[model samples]
Target: MLSEEITRLIGKSGEPMILEVERGAIRKFADAVGDRNPLIWDDEYARNSRYGSVVAPPGFFGWPVKWDSPMPFFSPIREELITASIKAGFSRIVDGGIEYEFFHPVRVGDTLVAVAKIADIYARETKGGTLVFSVTETSYTNQHGVLVAVASQTLINR
Candidate 1:
């Protein structure tokens, strides 16, 4: 079960993080995933595609790292939620699932801004034990301020 403090964190958004969609990063991600799509690796092939440039594969959102900031990529709100969940007796954690909605292709050289928020917190009872679930929703926008994608991830804690 979630306590009041933990539940209160729901719907609270974290600070926005900027991520540059570099060509190398996109290629690397595709390689790591064993995706050999020409659009991800061949610039010329991608140039003729509808996207008009090298594009990131599905689920290949850019990383959020700040070279100058002392703070890590994760926002304070996320850390707080984890801490509170642990305090509430959730010891083990597992990824429940992830759902992504893409409105546009993520092309190389495009800047993406991501903002994450705790969408919900709840608990369920099973034969093993009570499990707490937290849902996080992140919205990604392009440099032109166009909403590009939205990803929702669920985490389960026991």
Candidate 2:
């Protein structure tokens, strides 16, 4: 179980992230994921389609990470949640899974704004120990201010 202070952090959001979807990046992602869809790569094919332009794949939302930075990606609220869990005596962390819901089409050259929040936190007792589950939800909106996607990720601490 989490303390009141930690529980109070539910729904607290971190800083908004800005991401740009580029044609090259989308194509690279599609190739990396072994998806050879014409809409994701062939500009000529995409231009003839209804979108009239290359559209990003269903799961492609952000650009590739630059590894030169000292820190990977920082989320203050998420860090605080992890610290709280550690203080609660959890030593091992495991990634549960992530679920994504797309509302609008994400296209190449579109800029996306994403904000993530702690949605829920709970614990379940098992034979080994208590497993604390933390769920975070992120909302992705395009430059037009239209909500494009929502991703929920779960982390378990044991």
In terms of lDDT, the best-performing candidate is: 1
Put down candidate 1 lDDT per residue, 106-144, tens digits, no spaces. Answer: 889988888989999999999999999888888999988
RMSD of 2: 2.6
- Tens digit of lDDT per residue, candidate 2, span 84-142? 88887887888999999999999888998878899999889999988988999988899
List the candidate 1 regions with Cα displacement exceeding 4 Å: 67-73
lDDT per prediction?
0.85, 0.83
List the candidate 2 regions with Cα displacement exceeding 4 Å.
64-74
Cα deviation of 114, candidate 2, in Å: 0.3
RMSD of each: 2.2, 2.6
Q: What is the Å distance of residue 98 in model 1 from its true position?
A: 0.7
